[model samples]
Target: MDEALWAFGRASGVVALVLFTASIVLGIITRSGRLLPGLPRFSVTLVHRNVSLVGSVFILLHVGSLLLDSYAKLNVTDIVVPFIGSYKPFWQGLGTVAVDLLIAIIVTSLLRQRLGVKVFRAVHWFSYAMWPIAMVHAIGNGTDGTSSWFLLLAAVCTLAVGTALIWRLSSRFVESARLRQESV
Candidate 1:
């Protein structure tokens, strides 16, 4: 049962990371106002939202399973508060902080209309912080953090997201340049 729980937690964590990476890339694409082939602009947003929701579910599973597993030694407080865990407190705390940021992002998104776009957008920017924090948590705390396969997977995820981020920023820069030329 312990082995089963451990495996479930690890698998769920990996799945959550992949889903989060996809959502991040999709989010950049959505913000850039780019249409995926055969898909409308809104569809990209919908896909991003769905991916994020699924990722959140996986994160829940990861945390719940680990909590159940005696090996992890994760208490409720450790999961909620940062840097208080008996095991690798710093790494575990990163996960806690990431989860906190995710909660804030989710709550603000749900209340977007009521809170206004400015509030929602402000909170959403936390995602940029959340992703790296989560990644670091996985690398520092995961059982397979030192394994070659896990490193490969992490590298791939980083590359994909990094490429997408560069594209997003470059596009913004180009647009600003174009706007300046027009104004002048």
Candidate 2:
């Protein structure tokens, strides 16, 4: 029973990470208005939203399984509160913080219509922080942290997000520069 729960928790965590990475990449692509071979921007946006929702579900499963697994020894508070878990407090705390940030992002997104674009965007930016925190938490605390497969997965995720972030930021900078030149 314990082994099953442990395997489920690990698998769910990895899946969540992959989905989160895909969501971020898709979001960047959507923002850039880049259409894939057969996918339009709107389709990309839809996929991003769906992927994010699925990732969140996986995250919930990962946490729930870990909590239920006696081997992990995680309590409800450990899931909700940061830095207070009996096991691997620092790493677990990072995970908790990431989860809290994700929850905030999800809530703000759902309330985006009522909250207005400015507020929604401000909250959404927290996802940038949340992703790295999650990555670190997984690598530092995961049972398979040192495994070659896990490391490869983490590396791929990091590279994808990093490249997208650079592209997004550079494009914004170019746009701003062009605007400045036009104003001048």
Candidate 3:
């Protein structure tokens, strides 16, 4: 059961990172008017937003519980500080960075109206940095990281995230061109 829990936690981490990355990528290129062609007309962004939130919650819970499990031998500093874990410092630091980035992103999101668009967008760009940190954390620390099943799962996530990013960029390009055409 503990192994299963750990594995599940790792899975949630992968999913969360992927969704966050994909959503940011999508947001950047939404105006491109390419693949996810319906992105503008639908609730794609909303779904991405909500999903990332839920995934983050699950990941936090998982990491918190692991620290409490005794079997894991995690220190409080392990969670609060980056790269201070007994098992692996470099890989574990990635988790800490991700946590910090997530907090910043969420805090800024909550204050988006007050901060305004420019500041919010600048802070929000942290999502790109956070995702790869998370991916490295999961791939390096995950108990099942080397397993075929987990590898396949990670690969699929990478593909999905990549596709969404491409779609967003293209859509943004298309939208920009259309606007220019109309202006001319």
Candidate 4:
């Protein structure tokens, strides 16, 4: 029973990370062409936005379950603060980092208008950081890290997130050059 619950927790964590990656991809796709420069990026942005919201919800559930699980050995404070989890402070600290990143993402998203375009866009980039942090937490601290199913899940999660992030970053240079040439 305990193992099953742990597996579920890990699965939810992976699900949340996958959703976050989708959101990042769609966001880059949907942004303004002149400002963002992309191939058919808008619709995906909406999908990304919606999916990210759902991902956040799932992540909340994942954290909640971890705290609830007797085997996890995580206190409520451990979930919030970094390097404080007694079970495995170094690796679990990834969760702390992720939580902070999530809070920043949420705040900026909510106050996007107030934050303005430059600040909002800048902070938005950090969402990319959050995915890896969460992934590290799952892999390093999760009990199922060595399990075959968990390994597969981690691979998919990492691939999806890494691809989206790489595309987003790489396309920036290409887009900039394209815009520059067009202007010339």
Q: Which number leads on lDDT? A: 1
- Estimate candidate 2's alpha-carbon lDDT, on a 0 to 1 scale: 0.89
Clashes of each: 0, 0, 10, 6
lDDT digits (tens) for residues 54-103 of candidate 2:
99999999999999999999998998899999889999999999999999
Tell me the lDDT of model 2 at 177: 42
Over 4 Å off in model 4, which ranges?
1-5, 32-42, 171-184
Candidate 1 local lDDT, 39-116, one digit each (tens): 987798899999999999999999999999999999899989999999999999999999999999999989988987
Candidate 3 overall lDDT versus native: 0.70
Query: Which residue ranges in model 3 land beyond 4 Å of their true spot?
Result: 1-8, 25-42, 166-184
Q: Each candidate: what lDDT? A: 0.89, 0.89, 0.70, 0.74
Please tell me which model should have the higher lDDT, number 1 or number 4: 1
Q: lDDT, candidate 3, residue 130?
A: 79
Query: In candidate 2, which residue pairs clash?
Result: none
- Give the TM-scores of the predictions, in the order they appear: 0.91, 0.91, 0.77, 0.79
lDDT tens digits, residues 1-184, model 3? 6666566666566666666666665665443434464455346556556766776787687687677655566777788789778777888888888888888998998899888767877898797687777877888987777789877877876777677566655634446566346334
Candidate 3: residue pairs that collide: 29-168, 31-171, 31-172, 32-171, 32-172, 32-173, 32-174, 33-171, 34-171, 83-93
Task: Give the clash count for model 1.
Answer: 0
Error of 4 at 66 (Å): 1.6
Candidate 1 differs from the real structure by a C-alpha RMSD in angstroms, to one decimal, of 3.9
lDDT of 2 at 147: 92
